[model samples]
Target: MAKPASIPGLNPEILAWARRRAGHDVATVAKRLRKSPEDVRAWEAGDASPTYVQLEKLAYEIYKRPLALFFFPEPPEEEDPEHRFRTLPAFELARLAPDTRLKIRDACAKQIALHELTGGRNPAERLVFRDLASTPDSDPAGVAEKLRDYLGVSVEEQRSWRSAAAALARWRESIEEHGVFVFKSSFKQQEISGFCLYGEEFPIIYLNNSVAKTRQIFTLFHELAHLLLRLDGITKRDDSYIGHLRGEEREVEVFCNAFAGAFLVPQGVVRELAGRGAPADDEIKTFATQLKVSREVILRRLLDRGVVSRQHYEQKAAEWTDDYFERRRKSGGGNYYNTQGVYLGKRFLALGFQQLYRGVISRAELADVLGVKATSLDGLEQRMLAGTG
Candidate 1:
């Protein structure tokens, strides 16, 4: 690119933002840009100016703000009154997807029209989750780095599935720019493991009550991938199943899968554990055990990386998934997803109760907050008090 004529004027705000966003010393940017650090500092201080060519290159490489932001006087940041991150009442999300919480309010505004048309049924409530409904601008690689930093776990941190789940919790905690929530309930007759409520603070994850501990862990990560992709939608897959979608949803799903795979079993770490070479079926199982992920997940990863074949992966994965269901059925022939919901939901409810008793809120209101009957809250309170006393 030809360097343009030196411009007489430049915006200080633009240079300052680049300095802060890069989080590096002015000297560093100068060295990389092959300019004197003093000049860089002067440019930021609005004492020196860069040519149009230099400004264009700087704008593209760092900060990524449009050239207009530098010149235009920025209006003060307007904060939205309804920040979705705040805790909302449970009735607001009953059987609803997280992403549509905002829309749900709008629907309520048209309640008379909607109720007259649908006869008091709100099917859209259940369909509009936030996790599968977001629009993320960053790529998977960028998201992976953000997740690692947010969770405070290194890409090299290979641990148990439980530990990985804990890491996911940290990731949720790290998300300040976006909203996330865990929606738990004893969903009778529904086989849903969990769904994301995309683009809402109160994103819903519907955990099924009937799933095994191992399977539930996988579902947690799978739904999390939906969140990263900002997809406002639903996804159901058997263990280690890669979605073969097309179009916009396909792009997001692919990115989600990549994020989940990296978070669960980082490529570099897995490659090292595989002895820097492909391992056999038995060896892959051993690796899975070591990684604290399902054998199918590991096998698929290996196969995708050319460490295994389609035939080898499917043959082994089918056996594992089949035997898994068989063993689970033998122990208790119940819906796996529903079972998880009840167990985890009870725990979450307990926390909600404590928040109530502390006078942080009213008992009736707390029940309302969680979408449970007042009688249910009273019963749970008695049980909790009895157990403690």
Candidate 2:
């Protein structure tokens, strides 16, 4: 049998660079590529090379990098996750699951797509992140009220929505109307509820579609607050790290939590619902579901109002946080195209198709923008028109 031909002109430094960037060592790459460790070492040392097929697998499968990166003179400069999420501790950033990293990476690619699709300017008339900029130390309640007013969504209108799903759809549309592009994906790391990447013109929130709609709604606001503060953030199931943050970082995370709660269920409304005293567990659970408010937010509100003790709140919240997550996993299954629509989002899909129709982009480019196979575009558009996506 002939030995596979090695592809020449590929930079060995970039091969090593990509591997290190992806947090893998020589042995790991060798194992994944089914090659001896010495072979992997030789490839990175410029003494040997990988075949085109080997390079393709290494670029796409092992490192999750673009194929062209291997041909570059040197590795491109990308922001370190630690620096991007300034508030998160080094330990916290290190704990990010591999899938979580990929989702975040994909989210960045979507931002580039947005910039290219809209000619470097946001299509929205007003960009909320730029307009609503605030300090981490700013009054979260005031900021929440201002954001809610800017969104033009009121408590009465919020309650008027027939169901949580309807409210989510409306809130998502309203948010997109303001400039932030919201996208959804199934996060293999259930601990990650959602995250947001702040940008000048294309700030975005990426949510975990596997979570309950209530948690998703809360996460949207939590991440929105981060963007409003000109910061990138992650909302996780295990949020105990908030306590570990110090000074400005602590304030930022705390503000995100406060803003989401205040925006979703205002204090006055919660007080009114509680009436004479603290709400019962059932009432908290019921109202949380009906209004698409999170149980954690409700309990936190009660804790703030001197209704529930901090101890009670903490214990109860810890107990209930994982319930919906597991239930969501068990119940997950749906039509593929409809699911794709929901994941890519309506506004994004419409914009991509509009570009394709105008001849601004080709079918292959449209597929990358939508993150769908070119052949799958027809089925996705069908669902979008039927109002299911």
Tens-digit per-residue lDDT, 1-389, candidate 1 = 86444454456766766555434467766876788989888787777777666677666565444565566444224222123211222332242332233233322222232233234443233222332333444465556665666556664454633453454344433332233334433333223444444443333444443544444555666666675554443333342322333356456556665666666667676677566576766876676666666776776677767877888877876687667667766774544334333433433455567666676668776665554567676555555555421
Please give the lDDT score at residue 138 for candidate 1.
45
The TM-score of candidate 2 is 0.91
Alpha carbon RMSD to native, model 1: 21.6
Candidate 2 residue lDDT tens string, 141-200: 898899878989888888788777788888899999999999999988888898999998
| Model 1 Cα shift for residue 323 (angstroms) | 1.4
Best by TM-score: 2
On a 0 to 100 scale, what is the lDDT of residue 330 in model 2? 75
Cα RMSD of all models vs. native, in order, equals 21.6, 2.4
Instruction: Quote each prediction's TM-score.
Output: 0.52, 0.91
Q: Where is model 2 poorest over a 10-residue stretch in terms of lDDT?
A: 323-332
lDDT of each: 0.51, 0.86
Where does candidate 1 stray beyond 4 Å? 1-138, 155-179, 184-192, 238-244, 273-277, 332-351, 358-365, 368-389
Q: Which candidate is the best by lDDT?
A: 2
